[model samples]
Target: MESNVSELVERLGSDEDAVRKMAVFKLQGSIGDPSFADIFIAEGGLARLRYLTLHASGNTLAYSLTSFARLLEVDKGWDIIDQEVIQRVVELIVTHPLVNILRGAMSILVSIVSHPYTGNNLSQGKDFGFPALKPAVAVYPQFLEMLVNRLSSADHALCANALQLINSLMRESIANESDMQWPKFIQKLQDLGVIRAVYSLMQETALQDHMHPLIEFQSLTKVLLRKWRGIPLDLENPEHRRALKGIHLASLHERRSQDICIGTGTGTPNSKKHNPMKWRRLGFETESPIMQFEHTGFLGMMDLADYVRNHQDEFQKMLLEQSGKSGHQCCPIARASLSVTLILYEHFEVDKSEMDDSKSYLLLESRSNLDKLFEPLILHWTRLHIAGLHAFFRLWKATGAESEDYERIVELVRILIESVVGGAVRTKDVQEVEEEMASFEYSRLRGLQMELLELTYEDVWGQHLMQMREELYHEALQFIKEQRIRCLLQGAWFPSETSLNLGLGYEKVSWTYAQLSHNRRYLHFGGFDAIKKGRPELDALPEKIDLSLVSSVVSNVSASNDPLLPNEKDIPPASYTKITIHGHLYPVSTTGDTQKNDGQNGTLSKSAQEVVLLSLHPPSPSVASEWLDGLLMLLNQQPITAKTNKLLNLVSNYGLKIRLLNVRFNDVAFTAEAPPVPPRDDLDNDYYYDVFGGT
Candidate 1:
């Protein structure tokens, strides 16, 4: 097979076009196999293919591009492709006249820039070996502009391809904000007028007729607008100043005034000059109302908030109509449009006084749309439910305490919360419920609930609502805690350390299941077989440690310095966590026999002060770090406050570390030096309180 792949590679240098084309096709077929791919690349197949893409014409050109696309589909194939090759491909996409050639070129670009994996792997606390590649085509100066221009293409397929390519580039750029290229890439997209183009395309009757592409464009445009949303208006920049002026003008146009006739006590006409005397009149007097209007002048210069506001009715009608559509066919488009609407509402600063007059309209429309979302049938879809939840929060915040519909909004929120948590609790008996809880849908729901709780805690009305439904609120919190723990336990395998004296004659190393007891006061561990057989009894376990007796939990140890347990190469050093327990020791037999002797029984012994070190190896560093934080929480005996629970939940959900700074509660404080805490969307900026600090 290697010889066959090598022979085809050598044929790429043939003088006959037909022979080279056939060789490229054959190589494309063979490159799917990693071994064959290595042989082809070793024979300089990449360089040969690049040459054909640039110099060859017609069938050879198209075939070579298709082959490159196929090669990129292989695992880690982007590592072998160079930036120069990516640039040439972009050039072909721009200059090539053939649609097939253009399609093939776009496919290669998509393969290069798309995320390497699917779903929220990072949120799940898992790591992929391959980092997502940056959108190399952004380096080509005209590629983004070309893509924007292609949005108006007569060919639907070409336009769809352009949207996909643009979406992939934007997604990759946004996902890796640390990359220096993101700002420049975003500015380039904005400068090309991509957002306006997308909005215009969305309004087109033709595009709206096709559901999939319209949703894609809507989602892409929403992402593009994110960087510009809520950005402080720079009065120094003429464009920003103009945007402000346009907003003022639009407000004036929407404003209304009325004059009322009033009877005067004196029968005399009022003078227009100052210090005029009032006159009494038996009849009524008429007065002219002041009115003002100005030209908005070039909608392109206006900010997105004002732009959406200018067409508020049109956008509202469109979104409301789209939200009304039912079935799987329309769910995605509805979700995308709702997300876009959410961003617009957020930017509109709906909580401020300026939006007070329009609050009724916003609330009424949001409530009506939410009626569809809260339906028993529609609530089953998690994505749609999330969108509805977000929209509900925004409307609830905007409505404040003044609207007549405030109570109704509160009722809808309760329903949404119950719908999310109750559904999960009811599914606990299902076989796949554990897997379902670990899914991205539930993770997103959990994060949303945390944000809701925080919002409720801060607002006066929200506080009242919480008091009214305190039980439901606590249930929501418990649901979050359980789901977080479940996610942490997924794929977590702790191997017992060899150095510990388990009364076994020989060193024993095996996988064990570790979990918090039913009341969460004790940590228990038993053989993996018991857990696999669906019986994980805490009291029946051979080894149980009271969390209150735990002194400290240390991780990332290469070797144990304790004189009692010698350092050994029984487990990987990076994943090891050394747990120090004081006061009592519970030693269990390492043998597989289930018979419990008095010494091996899971019982607390009344012994003198003793320090025992137990080392465990988790699946990864993040998991080890999570276990460390959880144990520290237990050791401190700190009650789980809303803030602390949120922090722990963040650690479990996003795999971030909680660096306990100064934590103060009831005039007591605990401080620790650790790495800087990662920024979270839900945290307040006034002070970065330690998550371990009890509220």
Candidate 2:
């Protein structure tokens, strides 16, 4: 371990920046291991790392800080980080010019502030002990103020990092809401201009094609929404009250005046002139009353009806242009506009108790717009996100049964839920194959007549095709409810979809898991062989090699999860697992299995399988283990034979298989009289045959 620490320290001093970054990254992961941590500190490796954090240049400096933060993540690891190092990290945040370095510094500060030191009773005393964590609390107010100021940085990345740090700090405060101190902490954040900064970020990036800023903007706004929901608005404090009402004050005052005019069918009296004010127009214009009089908030939240009223032409033009844009089917702008239209239609009120006899021209027009958006939005349904769906649900519940498009919208939603996923085998590929092989029909005479008629018609007639709808609103509602519960449990709001195929040559076939059977050559996904009707193993692999494999599944090491940076060879469209059959490796691609039935056409459809053989690169470690297990089970379940015993012993000797009830130590252990090695010539011949598919 000391030798390893020395090697790492030498790498950090090397001329190659990448080598130095890798050295720091490896040190971070090793810090969790007590042995490695002890060796690092004992060899003065920790002191070397501290010097690098303060003096290193470029990527090396960023990496050093990141590793330093990870070192402090472990419990009692705080003892290793002193007040000077903590102050240095804060200084980096305040003074670093490079975005990457600032991001690293921000990460380290976030770790320091977020560390759980409240309950620990260390050797120093009963209440607090760790000086590195203790000083952070004292300086937090100043540190947070600095971050809030950084929110206006010219660099988008720097601003985003600062926002992320503030968000993390806010999340902790929200989590400890039971403590009354959290409310004051939240108010202090507001006072520091955090909310305004978030709003400015959103407004700036609302229409950009870049996704990172938009994602960051959404995260910051979400934190504000949580604060709005958790704590009541402090109307007593003038600044706090103004901050809460700032975004919608003009609209709120207008709505209040409109409410008075709508109530008596006349405007309030003009007191200065001592004359009664006359009403201009009723609530039943082409705009809905909800859109006209919504008071609390509008910028961050969805208020489609109101938006359309304010900028009707621009909004409609945006929708039309985005819907027609080529490339991605779910155009962001188009989907957002359509989703808002649906929301407005779902919430429009035709008859309120206050306006029992009033005409609902506004609602009637809104429902008509809904009729247009419902079909178009469904055509690009994949573009809509879960948040949009939640908005739709809220609007539906608010509308109740009064909407003219209520039944129609419900039917459309049911069709969307069923048709978006699965139902049956798509015979389209098979049909195309058949069509090419079969004889062509005689359309020569009809084609000529149609050609002449087309010339006379001046334009080709076209029709929009849509999936047939079913009245399964109740089922769709139940599904939405279940999704809500799932979101609550998982803390993940987006629904995962099956990934597209990567087109892996001949191995592009979709493979599924089949049930273990007594007689089957190939274990197909259907649980039974349609042709062979017998269990079968891979012919490509040697029979002896197949018998020695074990099977286990694990998550693929994604770029983020991987300790080292990714290279060109490491990138792929899908996750993979690798299995070692004998000594040869094979890769298997894996993903979630999504199956559903199309209620409209009454068809059962299935896409690709959850697991498939890649036959390209090495599979993930988990896939390799699973394959090994399956191979072992296949051999163990067979009738006892010399070949089976030899294969099992080979695998067991390698420590690949789990120990069975009976100990076969004599068989599994390596002995002096092992199998004789093959000659070089024979080994070369076998390798050539395996590569070229020879006997």
Number of the top TM-score candidate: 1
Query: Global lDDT for candidate 1?
Result: 0.49
Candidate 2 wrong stretches, greater than 4 Å = 3-34, 42-64, 73-76, 80-83, 98-100, 121-166, 176-227, 230-695
Candidate 1 segments whose C-alpha is farther than 4 A from its true place: 75-84, 115-142, 145-160, 176-246, 249-695
Kindly give the number of clashing pairs for every candidate.
6, 31
TM-score of 2: 0.31
lDDT of 1 by residue, 1-695 (tens): 66777788788889999999888777666667777777778877777877887788887888888787777777534444555667677787766778767877887777767735445645554322213222344455566778788877787777777777777777777666566466577668867976656545544445423334444444444444444433344556666666544433332213321111121112223323321111101000111100000111111123233433545554333333433232221212212223333433343232334234235335544423422211121112223333344444454333332224344444444444344333543113222332332232433543565555456554846655445455444544454555444433332456555424445655445566677776666667666531255545556667777765555565443243323234555533333345444433433334422223356667544433446645565545445545654555445433233434655444443321111112234222124455476767777767654333323
- What lDDT score is found at residue 258 in candidate 2? 24
Error of 2 at 480 (Å): 43
TM-score of each: 0.34, 0.31
